[model samples]
Target: MAQHEDMQEIKKRRDAVLSALVDGVPYHRFLGIGFDRRGDELTGVLNFEQKLIGNPFLPAIHGGVTAAFLEVTSIITLSWNYLWQDMEAGAIDLGALEAGTLPRLPKTIDFTVDYLRSGRPRDAYARAEVIRSGRRYASVRVEAWQDHRDKLFAQATGHFLMPPPVTEAKAGKPG
Candidate 1:
């Protein structure tokens, strides 16, 4: 039936988006960032590791590491949430990427982070909310927490430059 086929298609698309995220991005892998999806919500997790520790006295996760984690979480969430617009025909080209050729990454126009408390050495989790998404830019609000969602250690707002739309990518044209 058409409904069954639609479900299959949705599952395939979901896999593609997650594949491109965990495999395609280098920094994501380095950070041990993984996702836990509950319906439409995704919690990005940075698994605690000893190397990530910054302050020897308090033994906390590095501020920079936490910042990068939050940024990547926002980017991944946005990319997945807008896959139809972000990818080619809603299909992620893993083959083209294997050849070291791929679409562009959205550049950061602005990023502001607020460190509310020491990021204790433990698993870190982040969630991003897209405030506004436009053709040229997107604004995301992100928060990172350890232990509990309400107990936040850092929060950030980011504006990223979106890549050109599919209409701009033409045959025989370098994008």
Candidate 2:
């Protein structure tokens, strides 16, 4: 019974984290980005639509869309890492997350993308790896793939300014 309750608690935390990622940012919803979380790993999903096409000639996904996907993936992955720290310490407020008052996501310092090939007009998936994370900064690498994960359509490296942790006092809780 104790183990079952523990599993339920973990599931709740995971759901809250995903909600913060998908619903906290408006653009993420507008762009049709979805996430799949398996333990600590995440994959960003871009649901294809006709409106996302750049050139009807090549019928490729827009460069801007691809770039946005990579950037979003990196940012969310880094944010997840930060949130996990609080989760491990049992310091996260699930109510705040559910209320959409999540801690600020990291701000992008620089993002560089390499378009290996045109994104085909279909669903695209991306996975980000937080290469380095520190108190004040983080670095992430992302790869977007279409049909094959090994055959990437584009890849990116991003640096971000990590936000300071929010404390109970700052969050308007009695400290």
Candidate 3:
């Protein structure tokens, strides 16, 4: 029973993170991106719109849009990893995360995107994998796919400077 309750708490935490991802970031919402999360895994989804097409002749998704999608995936994945540690340590204020007030997202140091193929004008998906996450820095690799996972349209690697860990004081809670 205790294990089940722990699982419930974890799910609640994850859901709050997801909410912050969707509601806290205006650009993410503007781009119509959503995420599919399973445990620590996250896959970004970009629902297609006519505005996403850059070239009407080819009707391909915009290059800028693809890069933004990949970057957002990387940042959110890294932020989630960082916050999960705080949650496990019992140092995180769930209310702060829920409010997205902590602004705990890592800052991008550099990001490089490789366009493998022109993105088809349709819904696209992306998944980010963490290469390394340390105390102050993190690296992530992300791939975007349109129809199939194996057939990637674009991929990117990013380095970020992580934010300071959230403590009770930082979260505006009594320490």
Candidate whose lDDT is highest: 2
- Where does candidate 2 clash, by residue pair? none
Which clashing pairs does model 3 show? Answer: none
Ranked by TM-score, top first: 2, 3, 1
Best TM-score among the predictions, by candidate number: 2
Per-residue lDDT for 23-54 in model 3, tens only? 68889989999988888778889999998888
Clashing pairs in 1: none
Higher-scoring candidate on TM-score, 1 or 2: 2
User: For model 2, what is the C-alpha lDDT against the true structure?
Assistant: 0.88
* Models ranked on lDDT: 2, 3, 1
Models 1 onward score TM values of: 0.83, 0.92, 0.87
Model 3 score (lDDT): 0.85
lDDT per model vs. reference: 0.80, 0.88, 0.85
